[model samples]
Target: MRSGASRLDLLAARDARHALLVRHAGAGHPALVAVALNVPGEEKSPPGAEPLFRWALDQVIAALPGAWPLHVGDDALGPFALLASRAEAGGAKTACVAVEASHPAARLVDLDVYAPGGTVVDRAALGLPPRRCLLCEAAAGECIRLGRHPLDAVVARARALLADAPA
Candidate 1:
């Protein structure tokens, strides 16, 4: 959360994201891509985070054709960009997953695909493997749920990844 956003603010941001998905879907876009940095800790929009967010947005734009931004702004969670895509939901998800899994720095960005009616097209639904942990080979969700890594370590790793990212 940026500027000490409360839990309620975060929840509101989540709701707004869902609303964006529904709006795009209602407009006949088969899918929507929500891009946000996977930076750890409360100061999500940290000093160097926005550039990485922009990089991630560029990567998504390059990877998926016919995808264009529907919304781009900051939220309680941090900087985010939403894209509306005409590609089938499954295909759009697959392509987004590819973008996320393509590089180490890319893993620092979450590119989620949402179908019509605000249904998220998750990797499992498409039979893709779960995302791996930033610091280990274990599943990312599992590591996160278990609090397997210290927040500072995760943040440091994220910074390293960002530092190593191409210009």
Candidate 2:
């Protein structure tokens, strides 16, 4: 895949160790993003995951909260910035999630919660720590950004808020 979309299609995602989920209310649109790792000994695919990732973004977005303004994303930072812009422009709230892999909430995406666009944000803005994955730990060029908590943590909180929503 040449772009984020391509990255999604090309990725044969394995289970993630954890994940986080955030819930936003009253937003025009809601979306989820994840980042996955490439197994060490495994061979490489094409350049970027733009197309595959973008398409997957759309699917993931559809699976989230809001009913309108459906959107997909690649190039994690840029898209998220756009989301922030869109929400601000439209005066809509966003549910930011961080699910950890160590818990049940991280079960989505088989615990990987892998998304190209979302990963960069948590890494760049939140100060995520080093990855526990052996492949990432050993790789010299690998990026261990998005030091935020596992996806399960985020998902648990979001689910709680959603379950107890006002009647």
Candidate 3:
């Protein structure tokens, strides 16, 4: 909650996401898709974010017709949805990745694919290159871990990306 402003909130959000995966995995879904916007700063649900999140969710649904929503709502961590799908984990990951790579705004949406065992299906598992940074060609995770960019700068870039995105 609180848009992960503190460490505890971030942990709580992570736990909540894991719980979603576990709950759906138990329901016999072969794969699960989790969607959430990558808005920077403590203000995850900033103005304009929810609508962009909705658009991204719609893209995911269109990509995976077999997927059905298990949960869809906004919280301290911003707009998010968890869906259980009959799609195979690998194929689902591929589709989600395609969505993520399709547009700049799409890149700001985290479309995670999960296996029935509650483990995320990473890009490496599908032989895809790691995601690139929003502002550069470096791996996104590496940029995040190294603090290669300022928070405000990332936020501004995100805003610009969202502005260019289809409403």
Candidate 4:
């Protein structure tokens, strides 16, 4: 079994492979959607991670009409690799942000949308607000950029959020 830290590395490699697959498929703009977690230790794939990821993917699929799935990989790394053919990357990203915002486990789970080139699609480009901190109302980016909170605190809050999620 891969350690949680190594799982992240594996996820990066998988992402590169998916990008190549997207290019080979001749899709104008493919979207790679996955879960984002605020894990503190070497336990990236927590208990509810996969379930939350699947729920988020379902929402994205519903929002993006006519999106054809090109690839689907459910791994132990808690990264749900979903590549879909979409007309506009921005639209797909917007839908993903909406799902993240509406989900009960929104704080603990993140639905990230990546463009064909392997770069993450920005939520701001789609007129979405910056992601809020898992523990507070501050922007998540700011907290991360400044290392404002202890890792343990963030992780605990994430666990609590996951615990409160609907079964």
Which prediction has the highest TM-score against the true structure?
3
* Winner of 2 and 4 under TM-score: 4
Model 3 spans with C-alpha error above 4 angstroms: 1-7
Q: What is the C-alpha lDDT profile of model 3 across 1-167, one tens digit per residue?
A: 25336777777777887777787776778889999988777777766777788888888889988788999977668788998888888999999998988877887899988887777899999998998988899998999999999988988988888787766
**Predicted candidate 4 versus true structure: per-residue lDDT over 82-139, tens digit per residue:** 5564646677777767767786586555656667666667877776788888878999
**Pairs of residues clashing in candidate 3:** none
Q: Report lDDT per candidate.
A: 0.84, 0.28, 0.84, 0.64
lDDT tens per residue, model 2, 1-104 = 22343444344221111112222223332233332212121122222323322332343344443423322232312221122222221112112233223222
For candidate 4, the per-residue lDDT at 98 reads: 71
Q: How badly does each model clash, as a count of residue pairs? A: 0, 61, 0, 0
Q: Between candidates 2 and 4, name the one with more favorable lDDT.
A: 4
Of 1 and 4, the candidate ahead on TM-score is 1
Q: List the candidate 1 regions with Cα displacement exceeding 4 Å.
A: none
The TM-score, computed over Cα atoms with residue i paired to residue i, of candidate 2 is 0.25
RMSD per candidate (Å) reads 1.6, 14.0, 1.9, 3.4
Clash count, candidate 2: 61
